[model samples]
Target: MSNRWCAVVRCFVVGPIGNKFAPLGDPGRQSYEDSLQVFEEVIQAACQQVGIDPVRADQIAVAGEITEQVFRHLFEDDVVIADVSGGNPNVMYELGLRHATGKLTIQIGEFGQLPFDVNTVRTIQFSRSPRGLIDARNQLERALQAGLLDGQDVLTATRIFQESGEGKAEIDLPLPEPSIEVDGSDDEPGFLDNMIEIENQLALMTDNADGVASSIEVIGAVTESVGAELERAAQSGASNSARLALISKYASEISEPVEMLEKSSADFASNMTSINDGVLSVLGVIQNGDPSELPEGWDGFLDQLIGMAESSREGMEGLNTFGTAAEGLGSLSRQLRGPGRKINNSVGNMRKAIAKIDAWERAARSIKHKAANNPVG
Candidate 1:
């Protein structure tokens, strides 16, 4: 009831309207249209309660490009109430644009009909029943009051990524060179080629490992913030829909880092395979050749090779913990299609690579044993 909360001069409403936007003859056209009508009624009442005028794109009656006008409202409005029911593509796109502004955004949707991307963002949910409309209106009014009164903007995806340092700092790790240089002796053409390739591939894998490690930190920070928000929402004694909205919003917020983790893990897994193959090839050459006929610095090369293998194996093990975290988060929503599947696959790949490295490590030690025993030969 404070004038401070009612100080908003502009309000924009966006959502799917009746069959106007729905395809003709669609079986659910009537239902979609009806939901929009109810949503409009409730939104209007809520805005009126908060002493603000609400404008929807269809009501502008402008002669110019409606698309441009819509974008302008989405960006410039003091308050935006977006009904994301039906998961319409255009509605979702507009919602995303609004979220980028980090302004006051009120998301509402029909229960059980929200998209995976935003299903957890704090939302006012409603049905088409008379009682549902009243409840939705009351919820929206309180939301508008709290949002405008506190003067705090919604924590959006853009803000989350910015805070997570997604673009500010490069996640690349320094490429490591072999500690000892090998002379280009004519006796070891193929062996040198294989060893050099392994070194290059190992460098790339090291970068991936660094990326994965950094992403884990980001994920942890984001999750901690989300947990706090969840607790606050729960304490508010809000509806399930409201709590889910909070969860969904943070879930979306964490998505960027989760995606980074997936990609890094995947790249690391791929490079591990290539490096393993090269190591095996080099080992075969060493095993078949006379230890006395080996190239200069062959002993040093073996040491570096085993060292790289051990390092790679350890890095992969560390990354598996991140994979586990991703899987756990995905299970909560069961709809995080990308992060869940890809991270799990990367974990599987890393496990395989770990086994391969173990085998390669053993083989390398065997060759060293042979060289030690045949030192005088």
Candidate 2:
């Protein structure tokens, strides 16, 4: 081995001695310890064959917690050497992680001790004799040099060396051009996209609801002020023309604001209902675990929802302006319709929409309560 830095090899010496040695009886412990000593000797001999000291090798590392630490090391290390003699769960898990990370890994075991799954992978098998140990060490070193040192990558090596191999490589075929059909109606947004847009608009309404409600308060105040002025004018025997003119001017001034407020309030309420519905739909999907169980594309759906939520914040600000405008319109409309027609038709529409939204909101709350009591996951 020329002192060239090829790759970092993390050697994890896992077996019954390091993990489940104490579980065995007294006689078993002696046998286990003896086998571990032989394994250690073999590892040292293998390291020596490659002109590396087992104690001073920088690339080599060990792991104890196979579930967490071993997998973590597999990602961090370039190569892994797993001792799979004892059929340890931790060792198997670590090996799986190494294989998953697509890293170069070598398996070693005492003769006749390797598990069937591990035996499928080419591994060095050693006997207890001095000559057998030497032979095993030399074989392992040669295998490592070929697979790990000479850049014969693990994925390629695994595919080639494993008996039950992946099929021969197929030539890449060019994808055919998609057939396009011209349809003028297709340019319009789809139902889902429209729903998404509505959801975005609704989010805006919720964020500015307080501001909108405050504007409503202002409209009420303006209406009360105008009402008081009209009452005083009537008592003072003012001309119908002047009284009507004042009322009309006030109504005109506040009509746009009230209309804007009503529209925003309706939109706000609608958006709130839509948001609840969207959340419920997602929760329902999650609860059933049907959509989540999709083969590979489930993450894309989650990402789409997240993207919609993130982009809706800007739209909410526009809804706030709409609320202020609606408030002004409501103030103006109150003057036109006297005490006989107290409520404006636009306000009535808004109130109905708000009521529908409230029903949805309550239903959504109930759904949340039920979901909390009964979690699917």
Candidate 3:
């Protein structure tokens, strides 16, 4: 029986720290601290998952020569995790060495720092958020369970290529699309992880269905209340000035709720409009055709974007209806609108808004086309 056992692990925690001597910089020091914290959390989770001590390969480097110790760990460790957060040259070189070795190697980095070469390979995206860190750790744990416990000896191409006189052959066999395997309950979150969170949020919108109903009821109640007050004012034979006072008094009653709706509508519009920024990012990544596993599954991430886009469309629709309602409520008329509000006032921002929406549509279509043309394994 193969019993789970603790294992010696190595980390590229100090990337590009130096050539002969590890040079120290405040920026590098801060990066090391942050990246190391992330690495520590991930390794700890792996340890707990597979029953390993999660020993750092560089633990002894402090007592002796760092270069000799690091090079040894790079070649010998069963599993190695590299942090390429800043695209440090030393880390990149060491990562290349591990890549050549074809060992059970894992790579991680902060999202924005990865260069094209490194970014193309599968990597776990790191974030500093408490929840983000936890999610990253959970992802690492799942990956550890998948890669380590599977008990398979997959041959790495680099090992084979090095054996032949041909330095690096252009093989005819179609390269299998690289995928990240992970462990979790079947009900596990989608590739993005937050994908499940989005679904949960959409479900919460069902509760807001009740809110929408209550809003309607509130609208009716306010209407009836205002009508009654106006009726009383008319029956009392109040003058125009007095009647204006009466209506204004009732207007104050709905002011808060009206403001709340306005704020919500603005929020919805802003979020709806801003989603394009993320979509454009996806488009950029897809265009680059990086082989790495995305933080979100392409399909799932695209679907979530589609879902949010649809939700935002619906939200905009609702806001339009809300604006109409506000207009009808003569005394209680104040509402929020998107760039369309200023359509007549000026054409410039509205033109920009239309252009942005058009850009989003074009970008989305481009992504769909690219995904269709180049399906990943």
Candidate 4:
């Protein structure tokens, strides 16, 4: 993958780029430039956080047309940060290109400046002040670091499209012949070698499982925080529109952490399935073939199996904790949506959030059940 860092935006000016956004700069060019600088600073901070040298369109040499370079970066770069403030037509168009490819893209904009097309999608918002810049940097930095380590491209726009019930991009992968050889030749992997490999895989799965469990705890905490905020709004601002708006913003804020946890948990489950199959295959070989090749105590094979079983047990415990948290969500929902509640107006959005929590709980339970029913060794 190319290490190119890309930022998609237009020239900072008073008027909209392509009749897309309302005219700005009743305050003039400085206002435009100030907002763009906030975008630039956050991008640089995020790049540094993820260990990528920051590069912009003008900073890099290009042998082709400017549009060509822009498209290439959007498609080829590991990450492309887009600024959607003022709904710049060029930036929005390029973001659509990135979305079509379902590539990794980070979006930020000035608060409340985005149009409806991009508004429903998640976008980090920042102000043009020093404190706001620092907050924006920290928030984007955490998100970028997580994406860098996830080992998968985060297709945010694709998710938004699917969630909106729009048509999905069809994905098709052609299958190939099996690459693993089990002919028992010297060229093929021997018993001890395969055992060692499976052992390593088991360890990685266990670590990933731990990460998932920790993330679930974070989910529970964030959910409770949301509950508290809603209660506050109900008590003091049930009739206040501004308070209701603040409540909506806080609900959106938790989506980032929730999304991060969901991604990590899904990856954890996939790894567990692969590791389970691999360990069982190795166990079959050991039981059927010569056991003499293995050293004393089956050369740590049984230990690895036991470790995997213990890890699966821990994963189940985490799921149970998540279920308990889900119960809390149901209780909280009753209070928020039940009869005579002041926050009844906010119940619709809160239910959407609760549904997300419920889905996560079920996923955790399913993974735990699969692990429990399967043989560890």
Highest-scoring model, TM-score: 1
Q: lDDT: which candidate is best?
A: 1
TM-score of each: 0.44, 0.35, 0.37, 0.35
TM-score for candidate 3 = 0.37
Q: Which of the predicted structures, 2 or 4, would earn the higher TM-score when compared with the native?
A: 4
Candidate 3 lDDT over 1-377, as tens digits, reads: 12265323333333433222225656656665665576567656655666654435443312334665566456545676776777878788877766655567777777787777776577888677777778877777676667675722534444564566332322121122322123335774333444444445434433433343344346457768877888888998988887677656656655555444444333333443554444454445544554355554555555554444344333333333444455444443232222123211122222223334434443444456556655777
What is the per-residue lDDT of model 1 for residues 1-377, given as tens digits with 9 covering 90 to 100? 54443433578888876556568678458756765575567988888877786777876532345886687678667888988888878889998887776778898887878888986688888886789889999999999888876755446685875576541222121222332223445765456666767777877877887787677678678778988988887898878787677768766776787778777877876777756555666677676666666666667767866675556544554455666676676656654556667667666755665555545655666677666756753
Clashing pairs in 4: none
For 40-87, candidate 4 gives per-residue lDDT tens digits of 677676666545654555543213355655654665456767777777
Given candidate 4, what's the lDDT at residue 189? 78
After superposition, the stretches of candidate 4 with alpha carbons farther than 4 Å from their true spots are 1-32, 151-377
Model 3: which ten-residue window has the lowest total lDDT?
342-351
Candidate number with the higher lDDT (1 or 4) = 1
Ten residues in a row with the worst lDDT in model 2?
175-184
**Candidate 4 at residue 135, lDDT?**
88
Q: In model 4, what is the error at residue 234, expressed in angstroms?
A: 64
How many residue pairs clash per model? 9, 19, 0, 0
What CA RMSD would you report for each candidate? 24.9, 27.1, 24.1, 20.3
